[model samples]
Target: MNVELRQVHDSDLPVFYRQMNDPESLRMAAFTPKEPADRDAFDAHWAKIRSSDAVVRTVLADGDVVGNAAVYGVPGEREVTYWVDRAYWGKGIATAALRALVTEVPERPLYARAASDNAGSLRVLEKCGFRTVATASGYANARGAEIEETVLLLEG
Candidate 1:
């Protein structure tokens, strides 16, 4: 599959919001709850991403938005997060998007975390050069249970 990263635009907000609010997306992302209580928060969040040098890319496959990947937090030390549409799962979209994001940022010692039970996400992180360094017990509202979180890091 052909995969490319593009800056998210105002025109993409609706689709972006929809994908973000998807039940499956929330579950995979370990979101605390299913509530669209505030729009301003979402607005402010995207605004910062748009104005900052930090790279946030929308994954496109054959002209469709399949997922998103981003590097956030301070430079040199960054956190990576991504989620792909459940419908398109198992197609290497996350792997491709992550590889592209890493190339675009070139930041060292990036970090990522996934619920330990999320084998798919763990695999994606591992495939992209992140190594498990630690694990922590935490409440994952999306999973509706306390789970182990695996912390992974990629050093330049």
Candidate 2:
């Protein structure tokens, strides 16, 4: 797969919405919107991010939009995040997308968090040079309960 990242286009929102609503993907992601099926809220969230200083990008593979990657938050405390279509899981797309996102930002101390049980995401973050710094519990809307989350950091 030729994984790459590019500025997010208006046409990509619907694709992202569908990908994000996958039941399995939502469970794995854990920390997601309270209502993943709420189109209005989803659009509102995307609009907020797009208008902010967030560095958001669409992840493409072989010229097809496969997911999204972004780095958002205040400087010195920005966090990196990515979501690859479940169909593309286990194919190195997430790691590649994350690597590309970090490269574009060129900032250090990027942070990430993943459901502790989500080894795949943890592995992807680690592969992209993020190190586990701590573990905390948070309300996972998808899981409908509090769960352990692994905090990771990438520092120069």
Best by TM-score: 2
Off by over 4 Å in 2: none
- The most accurate candidate by lDDT is 2
lDDT per residue (tens digit) for residues 5-34 in model 2: 999999999999999999999999999999
Whole-model lDDT for model 1 versus the true structure? 0.82
| Model 2 TM | 0.99
* TM-score to true structure, per model: 0.88, 0.99
Query: With candidate 1 superimposed using the best TM-score fit, by how many Å does residue 86's alpha carbon deviate from the native?
Result: 1.2
